[model samples]
Target: MLDSYYLQDLDEEEKAMHEFNKDWKLSGIQRLFYNSLVKQLGGFGSEAGKFIWPTGVTNTLEGDLAIKDTGNQQIQIFSLDGYHKQTFSYGSESTKHLGDVACTQEGLFLVSDGSKGIKVFSKEGEMIHLLKSSKADWKHSYGLSVLKSNRIAVTDWTDGGKIHIVGVDWRMNAILKTNVIDGLQRPEHVAVTEDEDLLVTEGQLFGRNAGCCVKIIDSERALKKTIGPTYGDHYSFMNPSGICVDTSGNFFVADKGKNNVTLFSRDSSLSELVVTQDLEGPSGITVTKNGLLVVTDCYHHCVKMYKYRQEFIY
Candidate 1:
């Protein structure tokens, strides 16, 4: 549902005016227009399509999407527009439980599978390397992200949450968890920002501390800011399960309990619900280079795509 009038060819003055009107808080007709602009583009891997317990989703360097189907024990690939592309089957003893997926700039897929640590796969779906932490007792590898430097950041969903930094060596066929950030509650997913800071979704699984939140940790491993537990009076998260950052530094989070996706400004000064409907349990989330928002709904057993950025529309 595009505002085709805005999509029409406009004069330089109109284009400039549209740019000026962009990037602000939406309200009234503007909110309605924003709603229409951010629409469900397409979906794939539904329950009827034979996909079950799809947990993780990430954008590949080739602009495609890679999804981790935990129940089906396979990695499914799709176009940015949600068209079926390819599938990588994995049922080996090592990759018995796939959790989250992240792709490196070199087109390598890093998959998280509990105690098996992380498995590295080539673009052609060949297993290349296995990553395990020698320093810390490896427990569960849940969420994952690839940094600008090609290093990986993944969360451990054990009792004491941990974010492990993994180093890759393709030539040596060696990948190792090099560093660890300790002292998180139950970090479910993680995303690295343009500045190399980490945004981790963590909270207690139950009780009063169940107020799940996203923590912004600096490069030096210091807590910089925390968003949620509650935003204003209308927003409260049950589970902030998945997170991803956009080119503009704004981050989007998929809340499984709330069944919605929320956008947070880079500075953590503002937030808004971008996709508020039709999600049963959105888990893994990723934003493509072109700003397409992809979310995996585990409960609904489908991967949904949406046009997320307003500037991308104007």
Candidate 2:
């Protein structure tokens, strides 16, 4: 994703070069100013109607943001600049514990609500129905990502771990589970890459070295790459929760236990790029279409936004 802000500085030849090379690279120096904190959204309320323990957030195609306010048991919609839009609760159930939220191409809101499975809602906040899996039962649905071809990928926390890939119509295409063959454990959050691959964050709350890493899985549920304590030198994670990818193939991970966000390059060379400024238990992360980074801080009860710059190297 070439930013027009930076493209204006390049010549015609440079622009053509970038057009030719879709998968370009940026040197470590160019990534020195990769991301910086700029704006903040919801916070602890002095009056009322503010965020409390917001867990997940995702951007809509219209550039608006929908956040899963778990403490309030509702979803809050806001503009990109921190303006409140509207709020809606999922389903008709009395007890609702929202986990994560994702917006489809057609503007439908898919939210994960504990044992209730994924709830589909209309743009006007009308409850559609619960997305039922064709195969595996949703033990504890935690994370969600709208994949290509209108499919949805969600994670189930119980029984070691399980990832179910289903269509918006509730047809399960495939399911990945934890066993001696796969090793997926306590998957928290998920993201779909530009190539349609899945990036899942696996971590545990009360264990060490059991599961604290990010795994890149293909469409067929095959493991591709793992980034964790063994990936790079000095790379470690306590609770790797939320994850998101940019159009440029660069991905970001939010570690709640570490209270920071880490940026991993495309080829996995740069791994220790940590963003810790003004962050307290960063829980969810998402990159905007224009390159702004949005993260939800669970402990502080607010959402932080960052402006990022990208320089491509041919």
Candidate 3:
């Protein structure tokens, strides 16, 4: 897609923003001087909220939202209005840092951490069951999504990683090392459509095919299509990691490499890039019913929510 942010035609608003960011890109002593100076003036200032290296975020069962604050080693739940409700903390350490989070149909939360496993918890933050690493190969699992059968899927990007399909209650179902459609290469994040279909973002692909893509599969695990660079502007990904499917079937993906997310239609017929400002290496992402995009940035030490292509009919 043609990014308005980089168009040579350069609109006034775009030029202003471009110039500002160009100046904001400081380093070494310049960065230190800028920070010190900004702090003296009260602060460099923040938009609304700041999250510590947040890696994942998703919509709760009741339509609320949750964020994985990897930098702080905690999971924070917030109301749609931005009110912080609850937080689950893990010890402060990157090796065991939280990676992803998702809400089940029953209102439960499934979270993955750097400890080589997944953990189930109540909405209120009580620990439920720990999905041990022995259950699947995605030790240090990086992605998660609850499938239509109530089953959950997690992805591992280790040497020769694979997607492990577990039961609805979080037990092993199918250990797919091969592909039913396009070879499942280094699956990272996943989302389930209203029809129980699956969409997985491939992270290990490089070069011409560029691992920046997603795979479609049926509820029964049948591969549907490989929606990647071949789909033209409507389909392209650069280090696409995070994803979430909305009620209407359309989904959003965070392309951390490109610092943007692409919204694809239910039928894979259309796409649009969004949230072109203040997103620094965006990783995990999700969309609300009101059409707001909530995402986390690995480099910016914050989480953000904003509006994106909401005019689409469905």
lDDT of 2 by residue, 60-130 (tens): 87889888887776778888767788888764322343368999888889888777367778888887677
User: What are the TM-scores, per candidate, against the unseen true structure?
Assistant: 0.82, 0.81, 0.74
With candidate 3 superimposed using the best TM-score fit, by how many Å does residue 261's alpha carbon deviate from the native?
A: 1.3
lDDT of 3 by residue, 117-139 (tens): 66778888887776663435455
For every candidate in turn, the CA RMSD to the true structure comes to: 6.8, 8.0, 10.1
lDDT of 1 by residue, 6-78 (tens): 5376576534433423343431113312223233322344342347777888888888888888877788887
lDDT of 1 at 93: 30
Off by over 4 Å in 3: 1-50, 91-98, 133-137, 168-183, 204-210, 233-235, 309-314
Stretches of candidate 1 above 4 Å error?
A: 1-50, 92-98, 208-211
- In Å, residue 158's CA in model 2 sits off its true spot by 2.5
Of candidates 3 and 1, the better by TM-score = 1
